[model samples]
Target: MASESSSSSSSSPASPASSSSFLTEPSPPHSPSLDATTSSNIDIPVLISGAGPTGLMAGLLLAKMGIRSRIIERDMAPTPDSRAVGTHARTIEILKLTDKAVYEEVGSQSWRSESMRFYFGNSLVADIKPKPSNDSEFHVPWMLAQTETVKILTDAYEKTGMGKVERGWELLDTKVVEQEQEQVEHQQAEDGTTQDVKTTTRTTSWVETTMRRAIEGTNKRKGESVVLGTVDMAGEDEDKDYEVKVVRSEYLIASDGGRSTVRHRLNIPFPGRTRDYNFILFDGHVETDLSTSHITFINGDNRHSVGMFPIRDNRVRMMLDDGTLTQEQFNAREPKTPTKEYFEKLLEETLGTLKLKVLSYNWLTYYRVNERRAAEFTHKRRIFLAGDSAHCHSPAGGQGMNTGLQDSYNLAWKIALVLNGTAPQSLLDSYNEERIPIADEIIKFSAKTLDNGVYQGWLSSNMKRMMLSIVPFLVRYLPNGRSRPPFSMLGLRYHENSVNKAHKSQHYPVTGPASIGQRAPDDILVPFTAPADTSVPRSEYLAELEEDLTDQPIPTRLYELLAFPGVFHILVFAADRLAKEKDFDCCLVKDVDHYQRIWSSRWPGLRGVLESNATSEAMMCKKMKSTPQFMVHVISSATPSSFESDPNETTTTALADREAGFGKVYIDCEGGRLHERYGFAGVSTKKAGGGIVVLRPDTHIGFRVSNVESAAWVEVDEYFGSILVN
Candidate 1:
């Protein structure tokens, strides 16, 4: 086999490969971009294989956390077809929280689908809509083409100044290696000359990946550079040869679709089964008598069903189950054109009396439903499997792409923390512990949905019809009618782990609307007066607040404060009863001093390196580049009038003067909404008394304590201590 070494770093050579027939010695010269000092060498912190939504999202999250990553896509150009079109609510929340611009672009360009209508034999049965939740603003899915989603993420990632996706590059293999390396630093002397005066030896482990240029040239359309879309059918060059290269990186994330090369190369068994059912999906312009505003499902004779999803401007995606043959027979059949006549006939059979005319088409394909998952999400703690690489199942609920996007979101922050020395290497283990279970649940959920709705038998068909008949009523009146499983994905949560845990205090139980590992609910809050305006009398400021609240800086949402990247949001709720008690300072802002130190400590440079005995100021400067980890916010149950003239001047001393641990502080102005949502309203009356909640970087509740006293502060410190490093 022909291969090329990308790195000239003789000190840190590519790790030895596992015994495989594909392994071979270097043959071709290295590509200029892959050389040691350039793209693929030790300087790169992360190497992501697959530029699909998952891989692109991973790169974006890393960039948001102030870490740089390289993404390589095997395909030279994007496919014209929109493969996965349903971007779910939870995925929207993740995008909005991490990058608002990307979220806004998607919201504006995509179709927002909040309701779905189901019919049986031309008779409408159920019209279902998701219930809105106080925890998130998004309760509907965004129906955008996968191609468009990739373009948006690509644009946002490129704008970060990190770099663009390296298209046509394919990963062949990977192996983990450990070695001691020398880090050389050049310092300017008094003579105005640079000298390599500092050299440090550090032991590090990295994944050495073998990659190659599988294709060449950008896929352009009509002489315009195509940022994304399907491969150009007219640009075929079968005679071109390929070049191979090997590069070393600290971490490797595999998101290379269901048939992942990285998964196969590692010999990881994808244990699962493929069902006999076959599905035909096509996107096209269509004219129909049916309502095209929301997703619609029609069931006809022989248990056959078809789903229609609106794609903007008269375009609709049609999916139908083809029972003409088993999956095996369908796969073995001779190739046939998916002509308009053929699809029209298929829809006529599935739609019964309903009529639809296929005017034109862009893409069409067929596939068998396969349920599979890797045995391990991570290998050797250096290589990770994400998206379809880790697990895949039926696309019945339009959850495939959304699940993959979340997988990257879950893993990115942990990797960033570990790489930046903010968290221990052990922190990475939580990725598998948390995401694998979610993957398994999604797999089971989608499989059941496919069976009940599309590929149903006689018994299941009757049961599904009965269920569909009552769905409208249940959805309208039921308490949990809003966010259903596998749709909103709001209920997905991690179990207690190193980063997600309950308090060690035995005196009281941590009670809240959401558990320790669930999503933190969102609520409105009134911002504290600006430092300059804090001296204004309470009566004077109240009038300004009433007129043009926006100009006076109106209320803020809980998520708005939590959106800061890679930082733990500590919500300190000062309950009303506790605030009215004697020594209210002790109950409210007593531990603000301790939190300030912990918050400032996140930046290693500002704190002077907690464990550093650096020889010079330059050495100290390097450590200061570390990213901050925690942001503390104080929410009080007291009124806006309690601030100015109070004897303690708690708001002035703790908030306006010190910045409240360098984070925002707000008041629960809306009839104790924030307090009740966090289960802190009655906390003062409880045996243990509690009001502290810690939200992880991903917005899930990581930890909570019963009180904000000195002891509770210790518990909070220990919670962070479990995952973060000094």
Candidate 2:
């Protein structure tokens, strides 16, 4: 389980070979039965190659979607290197919805900052800070190393009970093969006897992968948990040879980093330019006069920019251009900057009068930056290239890993629905349609940033300084003024994706300016429900309800319900009680009836509807997760005691109770804060204020349905019908 055990010989060539000999040998402490490597030729619906942050993320997401996958990594242990350090806010929100605990787990070790400090050769240029107020408490991006991010995702995937990552295994080759499977069915006869009645056979295309691993399988990979009866390969080895194994899967996702062997074999063209400068990248402890509280950049005449960002344990990640030789000298088979003295020279030059020194290093390397992307992300709709395999760029602002994380998020659910018969094959096309453009944009922006960062000119440097000086003032005083959206990733949207109806150019009028094809905005909700039996004013008990906080179940937030996995969320903003008429609304139950018919007509096997307003007596018992494909939540203007009692019927009249809250209950609150936010402030209460918001699994608002029973809902059917299975 030690990191050293799985390190590549290329990574630490000076180390003794005997040190890794034990990697293939079995330890005495482990039982021989546990030590034996069992191989089975099994068919998997989804297979992922590479177990880095991207691959691990894809596996975790698929598991949450109720699909199983096998993840493979070439290395025998986890690496300690950290390529990504900034986890952006958009990624944070995405993680929150994927697994509620992941956001906090990674957040605990991550550092957050609202501003950054800049110095031009020891002289302060300006402090660039974002204007505060109004987003979530955890609005800022967190700095966590990529290794730690991988650990968190891997742990979460293991706990899902769907699949495991096969470490110490390499994907040697993959071939498309046609496979046949025979299925059996049984029926009961009228004689009260069971009959083995029917049989069906089918042939399908599968990707057969040839995998290799050490035959003896020496040590368990780092962060590996104890599987009830598995061997911990942590001791010495008697064998050095490897064993070849084969596994079959319907689809293959290649997330094998920038230098992908899969991409190599496929002969895919990785088009882009590689930079000439050799840059020193390191993570280590430093002794410096500059503060480490925020992102600090050392600039010198725009020709040299050295980035220094603080990390955990008082360590820092430093990057500086290695300018010792000419471009021609380096191209003539010259060695990269080898000595630690070169790094010291960089620090001395950038820091100028300030005292800054690197005392020790966790990792250090010199490399040329490559800005490249694969020409295509898919092959035959069965193979996918994700993360580094799809695109690569300078690690400016740590955008590489963050972009890759989004790549997986964009693909997982679409594939999951397809494999399990919940969606159609056509849905998969949107992956390339949507993500490739984002990848293209990130590449363009990162490449430009790198170029402009080193731009040397009379007008540019002075302009940059002037802009930085005034940013804080504008951010502080301007109304609705704040940091740019790109940094927070809130600006990311599918401008013209096949699945999203609205173009990115269109603007949404809702509060938060929520837009279609963009991340859905969040809002608060006040829980509400009228007593099942009587029409009584809530003011009579409203004060008592607030006094005993635990006794009264207050309203929940919009994000809370979206966290429930694998369903489309429909938010119905029902009309509250009429001011003068003072009658409770009936549109909610009617909307429920509309959904019931839709479910019965098209989706009998799927659970999708969650009604928050008036629940029929038959459906008040099913749990949220068990409710299949649709979730319905209501926001009404009425309170618990505002309904008329129905004494004639035996149905329970218990609103606001736990059972009544199955789909969740919410009140519009005094002055109708939420009602106004969704554009239903003052309206006739004679019927439901009919509107349905369709939210995707990723929480992007796909489109809106104006009427639950009109042809608009039929468009909803056509939408899902286009992607979802019949």
Candidate 3:
């Protein structure tokens, strides 16, 4: 998909006669199905407005969680314009977890930045190189056009067996409705006949949306703006020209850009100040004396600045800010649609002594910067505002699309669990609690970056440039040594809530420092069971196993093991073996047993626990599914062979295997390196030495306890009980 559209002023006007012709026309190819557009309504699990990156991601996530969704877009095709040009590390991580193949495809086509170069009057000021991400393989932002991102997400969503995006559809009106429903139950009699047992009345809440699509060969308004309060006959004719469709959905996700009609319809107050900064942006091929390998920011006379960000090949995204407009003109600023030649001259003027020439161009856009966020992200617990609908800010850090993608990542799972009856509706509150703060942070960070970008003879701007020059040296002194910048979004953490618990709840001193609400840190681990190769000799395989696996060149990461969708993963850090001990329980076997039994029995129907009396061998032969709510993995500092106790003393417990009810076993065989990373370095062989870490569906550290005692296990159960349904 092309990420550039024609100038904003190129929209064609419409006549009244064309608008009323819809009455006699057939449904167009992009219109919704006839049944869907008729008087009768179509029911869906989730309805998404706008098929942009955020909406498409929400659809994909819901599908991964076993829920279906319908995405509707007003545009007949994906917008040629790309409002966002890159995705940060956090967004890429979410995409990788959602679908690895899609992540690889996007990453392969994106351009990775090497560094950022700042210049004042053609004199280089700062050349800052990006630091690698400590927690993820994707360290920097992957510079890809937003149109390409939407295309990839759309393809992934369709492959989920969910329906495709319903194009040429506009949300006409939407509101929450309550209706009384009648449900009947039947019972089987002794004669093997069905009998009506009971009838019940229940009140259900749903979002009822009225959708509209202009009938082809009619006055569809083209791209002309239509005022609702106008008295023109053409407006009246256009009003009733489109086909009306009714949609009933349990939830609605509005990702429909900054001019969100849904947000306006809901009367949600969008509060923020619009800056006086106006700029013209475009993507094109450029021949220049300066290097294109890095993102370059140039400041010229009269406060003019130009930013050149390399895309692919020789093309670059040029953002030129003249900074010449007066306060009053900026206050009443409208979009400026100048020709390609105009932008070329402006770029040369901003470049000063630096020579550059534009050989070809894609598209250009002119607008002032506006930083705004909706007062509320959710309404009535049924309607949600995501992406640009929730917040909009300057694209200083290339954070517009990345932040929106993370918003969907945070929202989709909560909605899925609630709809599946596994979690309570109150869980939905955390979406707002967790994401609004992140949005605020992004808004503030981007505003600061924009304000301090160009020199313009401002002391503050020059000072900031000087500070940026030494960022590489300054980061080395900070904790974690600046693997990723804060704008890359790896440093954001959620505040303590029902979902993100505080460490003080646990009396044990297990979790070192404090990371309960932060991203679950990553480390290397040796799997207890290695990948098998039949061609290899048994002796060679045995030899390889005997060697320290963690010392091998390529080690498995903890994130790879927690990549399962919509499930909570519990990591039990069981420390080393004690030769004096008779059994290999590591003082955690009883705790693990109680955790397994309670999880398997508590929410039988809700957890999707498959009841089986068959032996472990039979279960393995049948390939039975694991419990949906929880997955447990035990990581021991001891090697697999260490679990075999001395037979001469006593054989009290079974070996650490699936049959022994210890979940899947993994080895932290790096001299407890992985254990120490989680603050279990010099643990005693008793119960207090090890701890439990719970990874939420989004891979954030939801909860942690110091010891594997019954009291700790009970607290873990209570954490789940607070958010999950009865």
Quick one: best lDDT, which candidate? 1
Q: What is the Cα-based TM-score of model 3?
A: 0.81
For candidate 3, the 10 contiguous residues with the lowest summed lDDT are 1-10
Q: Residue by residue across 1-726, what tens digits does model 2's lDDT show?
A: 111123333221111223323232221211111011111223576789999888998988888777788998977777787668888877887787788667779988898865678777668877777554233323567887888899899998888887798897766566555434444567888998888855544444546565556555533344442211112233323335555555666678999788765676566788987777667788888877777767887776426778877777667887786654455666574444346776787667766787777889877777567788899888656778899889998877578888888888888877766665566667778888888888888888887776655535658877777787776677677553134445667667775456776522233453334456666655545544333444444454454333322343434456666664456776665554422132223333544546656754564433322222112332233344344466666555544345333444232222244332233455555545455544455744544444556677777777665443344455666666655666
Clashing pairs in 3: 18-219, 19-219
Best by TM-score: 1
| Candidate 1 lDDT by residue in tens digits, 1-726 | 122254222222222242223344322222212101112235367889989999999988888777788898877766677778788878988887778788889999899777898988888888887676545667778898898999999888888776479887767677776544456778999999998965644544556687756334522224322221222324433444445566666789999888776887788998988878766788888898987779999887746789899878878888887764675586477654355666678779888888888888887766577899999999877889999889888878888889999999889888877776667778888899999899898999998878777745678777887888887676667553234545778778888788888766433333435677777777656666543565676556644543322342435566766554566778888665333555655434557666657646653411111221112121112332433466677776655554444533534424533332244456675546678777676554333454788998888888887677777878887777677775
Report lDDT per candidate: 0.69, 0.62, 0.68
Minimal lDDT window, size 10, model 2: 30-39
Give the per-residue lDDT of model 3 (tens digit) for 162-205: 65798877765566665444456788999999998666445456
